[model samples]
Target chain A: MACSCVAAHLFHGGDFGMSVVIQQIVTGLSIGGVYALLAVGYALIYSVFDFSNFAFGCVMMVSAFVAYYSILAGCSVAMGIALAIAVGILFSVFIELIAYRPLRKKNTSRLFLMITGIGIDMAVTNTAVNLLGANYRPFPNVSVTEPIMMGNIAVGKIDIIALIVSLVALGILWVFLEKTKPGLAIRASAYDTSTAGIMGINVNQVSIIVFVISGVVAAIAGIFFGMKYAIYPSMGTVSTKAFIASVIGGLGNLEGAVIGGIILGLLETFVSGYISSTYRDLFSYGLLILVLLFMPGGLLAKSKSDKL
Target chain B: MKRKLLALLLAAAMVLSLAACGSKEGSDLPGITAGKTIKIGFVGFLSGQDAYLGQGAKMALEDYIEELNAKGGILGKKVELIAYDIGMDPNTETANACNRLIQQDKVVAIIGPESTEQAMVAIPIVTEGKVPMVVTTASNPLVTVAEDGTLNKYMYRMCFTDPYQGTALANFAYNDLGLRNTAFLGDVTNIYCEGIQNCYRDEFTKIGGSIATEEGMMASDVDFRAQLTTIAESGADSILLATGSYKVVSFVAKQMRQLGLDLTLLGVDGWYANELLDLAGPELEGSFMTNMVSDDDPIFADYIEKFTAKHPGTTPNVYAYYALDAMMSIEWAINQAGVANSTEIMNKLETMKDVPVFTDKLTIEPDTHNPHNKTVSIIQITDSQFKTYKLYTPEDK
Candidate 1:
């Protein structure tokens, strides 16, 4: 049904014919797959902490740089990817310990935690600018750049790689959350941190687990982002889409984040394909407002009227 | 919490004040006590990505000022430079820089605040201060002229506009390279990108060529496969990037090549940087760039030597050359007018033409204030060197 809606909106007046729309949707799904990876990371953090990690994009940036310099240091792309994820997990854990933990210890208001995240984001971004000298650098040639031709439609190698990796990561994440004991602890924390602690669910351990997962996934997202585009200090700014996607899918809901991300990506590509490339953001943001006004809980969010 | 907020605010204020200090290193400025110093204020970006340009500009202006002073100065008064560094794209920083130049420094003329974005912020203050300023190397057309297309009285550009950049690309792609089916990718919110894209498109279509695909990237976008895949299906023979950032363009170019498409990569002035070789690497070897100034000019051989000597190991781009030219151009006007007054200098500049600078013969086109009769050179990266491909004038009057 969503595919049909995309086709209807993507074709500008049945005059251009029934072609090229499938190509746009496939490409969009790939792009959306990367966005979903980043969005789910954001959603996972938000679910447990109940505050946005504005610094989430910066963690991805650190991953990209780690992967970039690792490759330059004679490591293979796959090794760099692994090293980046490992580094991302460590860095995310460190940030949670230093920046977020202090606020939690103080029993601070949500505003202060959000502000601290912004400060962390700014600090990380500035440090990168100072260290990297603000030049955009690309990751070493890694992913297969050639596109696989499937009849009339074409699929890029990087897009396919991104989609497959993101799907696998999300699947693993789903299974972990649903079937594992630690996942149950995380879920308890997500319900209520105070209550979770009272129920002997070590909230601190759960926080570490959440950070590690989010950070590892973001590492993939960042490296893929650098592979797709070039890595620069300001690449974090582009991750604004992930935050928006999370919001669209209903913040704090991992499944909703993936759905929202894919939806946003499809709508963006359709607008660019059909209406005008310039109006793509205008349409996407407009849709975001409509969703917020009409369905505030998001598309697949669980019933939590009090939360809304 | 209140105390913490106060400390943070105080820290921020201290940093800002330090940036605004603009450091009075060279203002020993002969003739200051004699009331005969021709004070000219300058603003160059000493921070951020384009900081190298600022450092070069500052070096060039200081060198030029010393040379003029050694030669008994402009119209017998020693040229004193009051310089400031615009840290980044902070509006408050721009406002403060402009305010310091006009109000605090009391300079007779002003030079710079690079890029059209900062220049735009500096415009109203310079206009209100009635201090004629020569902005360096920013190609956006609206910097010299108003959004309504009327010329601003106080601001002047030291480089060619985007329309000229567009003309160079179209003529080179059509007449020289024989590419008719071209695709364009640009960021919509960027004035420089949008302006050049529109100009290139108009000129390309006007000359019987058709655009294969037009794709837009948001300022924060990193993925171009969606657009690249779409363009591949459209069968564009070449791709022209109107995105202002070299990194963004290089990424797009790399992706285009990697997508198994054999397409010619074309670029605007934004692509001409020393760091481009590293960013784009072999992917951009055969790529062509339309630039305002070609490096092959024999006239600037001496200037180039001096600039490289001053800032050893830094290869100067068109921006550095323009900064050198801007300083010299202002000095020429001061000499021609026989006074350091702003009004007289502006009038002298208005009627001034045929003045040879670092680039070529330059003129402030009667009312538009654009550099007239300037040649836009088409160059390509051959074996990592910017080899000259072709040259054509955007306007000839």
Candidate 2:
């Protein structure tokens, strides 16, 4: 009878429990979707080039600045978004040709690439600082202020929009990677560049295509992030947190990135609401460490292997 | 081998250039006379996460130095400011920076250590070095005052200490605005917030005002919905925001609007951002804040014109004024001392009274080295600007 009573108490106020659960789920999905986008970029570049690009954060920051400067120059919100994406594409291409291409020819070690990547990151960030004064500036608002009511829970319009757009972009990317001929060539290059080259696949062209897509994903994330939070010259540091999300989700798994991001987001919100907000990040990272201890291959690793 | 030789020559040239700069130092050196070149060092958070404050302080310093140079410098010396970026981790770097300036650079004085945390670390170093240092930011009284209630001889400050500023805000809310019941939202991570909260709490309760809710938030928190909801439901007459610009604006405006709270908002100098007005929109229109100076004051106007004429691009922030006041105060102390020695300047600085500037008519108490009889401005935000409602000098209340 006591056990039954406790269960009843836990499940009491059906509407409240349902709404709270829904709110947590929605918040997790929205933020996780953002993490998924960033992880996809990180994973794609790593898989193809076997290189860690430290300048990824700077790429995002520069894209956000492009959007900021565009809006400040009397452009509409749509124009700002377009400018960010365009700049991201251009920057990615530039970085690939200037920084990565020569190293690729030399078949540089992963460590060497990582060091060069850090140097590039510093150069880019410092250049941005020199050009734009170090101050926080707000992004032009494109989000509708109204919160869409879903039962007892409410979600902002931007949250819903970001989730939808992220899912759509991810879907398009998945199709491009699976259904197209270039997709197979890219995968072939990832597994064995020599094999791909012998099979008449232009590996260099595939690498450029991969970078372009990664840049677009990062730029979209950057634009959406700036819309939510204010932009600063060092705002790239925020991406470092997302990188943590990426690592927790599993380093090379795209789907794991999504799962990890959502789980981390939900963990943060629930902990912040119930426990101390100061310990929210602590809880998330602690959970990540615990999960790694138990599941060394990550939660979504099984799914990726099964599909492969 | 020729390429290697070229690289060697280039490196040697760079070292040679640096050595030339190194030799041309110290005011009393044969080639460097006191009236020919004045060297002052600025140590602040010039790089790292909190670089924004440093940027503002640097802008002000640049403007003030230009103005001084144009006006034939201090006693005909061309004032040259050598700045060092101490970063945010002041405990580790501030002392080293101060030592480098005093021992190696041989600057006549130093102008900053922008944050209170940085100042605390730097004060002891400057005092021990016997070099005069003027802190350009706020720290509590305990920083300068010894346990025996004597001021550190080499330390001085241009900004009002947090206790006075905090109490001034509370006094403004209770007496000037006639709001009695208040709620306090303190940032636990910041010493500034904690100091101000304590002062306001004590002063408000003493003045017959009740604090309905007292809650805390971390400095980095952007959301204050839960706290604001509690404040709104508590039936408080006003809410005291005691955080920096980013969190203060977003949390107050968004949460207040969300909860439909009609309480008057009051803040300290932390709310002095044009972006805050933009972000907060109509929510900040009738808000009151206690500040040290307002941009529209005639004293500030003359300074602004002079600053603008000299430094054409950078807009003068409040920190610039404080930085200017800091350097100028040191120049004045040195002029009064009529000597280059640290002890002579320290002696003159301790007994400084009625030092007039664009910001205030400051008089330093001999015992505390703190500005006595200073003026505080009560500003109201209307149409996204600070309109000075009242200028309360020390004698006023």
Please give, for residues B83-177, the per-residue lDDT of candidate 1 as tens digits.
Answer: 88776664578779778877777777788766777888888888887788888877788998998988888888888888878877887799888
User: Interface RMSD, candidate 2?
Assistant: 11.1
lDDT, model 2: 0.71
Candidate 2's residue-wise lDDT over B1-397, tens digit each? Answer: 9999999999999999887666543434322123246678888877654565666778777766787789887765677888988764567788888888887776767888766777778877887777778887655776677657877777887777788888888888888889998987777777778888889999999999989887666666544544553454455778888776554565455445433345688888877766565555554668888887888887678767766776686557677778877866777776886654455666777776778754776677777777775678889988777899887766633
**RMSD (Å) of each candidate, 1 decimal:** 8.2, 8.3
Model 1: lDDT equals 0.77
In candidate 2 chain B, where is summed lDDT lowest over 10 consecutive residues?
B27-36
Q: Candidate 1: give its CA RMSD in angstroms.
A: 8.2
Model 2: CA > 4 A from native:
A1-30, A46-52, A100-112, A141-154, A184-202, A303-308, B1-39, B45-93, B146-150, B173-187, B204-240, B245-265, B275-283, B335-340, B392-397
| Model 1 bad stretches (over 4 Å) | A1-19, A76-79, A141-144, A303-308, B1-36, B70-72, B90-92, B140-142, B145-151, B181-183, B188-206, B211-215, B228-240, B258-261, B296-306, B394-397
The CAPRI category of model 1 is incorrect
What is the lDDT for A229 in model 1?
Answer: 72
Q: What DockQ does each listed candidate score? A: 0.21, 0.08
